[model samples]
Target: MVSEKENAHFSELEKLVESIKQRQQVVIFPPGIASFIAVNILLIASFITFFAPVMTIIGDDWEMSQKAGGQFLVILLAVICIVPPAILITRGKKNLQRWFILLSSALAFMAALMVVVGLTMNNEAIAYQSPPLYVCIITSSLAAFLAQTSHYKTLTLFYYLLHKHE
Candidate 1:
């Protein structure tokens, strides 16, 4: 006992839903592209940081490795951070835009945590004899900044799509 008008209305509703899905595919591009760019920047920074001095012990000719301090840990962490972006760039699902946003936020939080911890660490003695804290601070700060920017932009656009009420 279905009316022709009711059936047509259902058909139209399906089309609207399908159209929104298609548009979402286009909307997800910016965040994914940003992830790709982040991977490249992190890789380059990690390389330069490896050889950079972490600390220089004073008055001691005693041999010490420059790569044995917080910088080493920071560089390793930076490398791990790059892997997520690479995976996202190559295999991100269109339906997982919200998941992408969460991942980005988590990445940003991790980096920001590193920066905060670095700022609060007892670096008075360490700073005199070790590599610059600025390297760890700068590298972590950069990653956090990029991820947060991506999160903000993607979230703004994700919620911008609207359905007509008229």
Candidate 2:
């Protein structure tokens, strides 16, 4: 019951799948890795630039920007590094982890935006102050988030659609 056209289609699908499997060994780069790295660097720089200077300028009463507080940023960055590699190692089709990666990337992007905003502020008296840095941080963050989320969602949806009948 197989026509030539159907057989040709099957052959093409087979070749596509094989090609994908072959390329799976390539080191796939995630879109958000740069953002994560930038965030980490900015966090350290902010601690030094904003916090240290503020402390020296105003003494005990003036606290550092609490936006990049605690080990959360570190943990987030580690996750950013770890998750993509794990997915790449295991291949990116594992549904749960794939979703996790997308969600985590979104969070990190948002955090970076917050940090960028915190850094650009001219206010020394406001808690979580908003400054001109808000513009770049927020704009970049929004762009990063939108691109990663869109790519992730599109890939996930495509995979599900492809396998839906099975």
Per-residue alpha-carbon lDDT of model 2 for 1-166, expressed as tens digits?
9799857855664455555556753323364344334433433333333333333434444345543342345445545644464344234353643444444445445445545544666435432433323433444344335434544443443343334444
Question: Number of the top candidate by lDDT?
Answer: 1
TM-score of each: 0.36, 0.31
* Model 1: per-residue Cα lDDT at residue 54: 29
Please write out the lDDT profile of model 1 over residues 1-166, one tens digit for every residue.
8699856855664465457656742334566466546635744463344324322323134344533554566566656645554444344222333443444445445434444554578545444423343454455346545544645334323333222221
Worst 10 residues of 2 by lDDT: 46-55
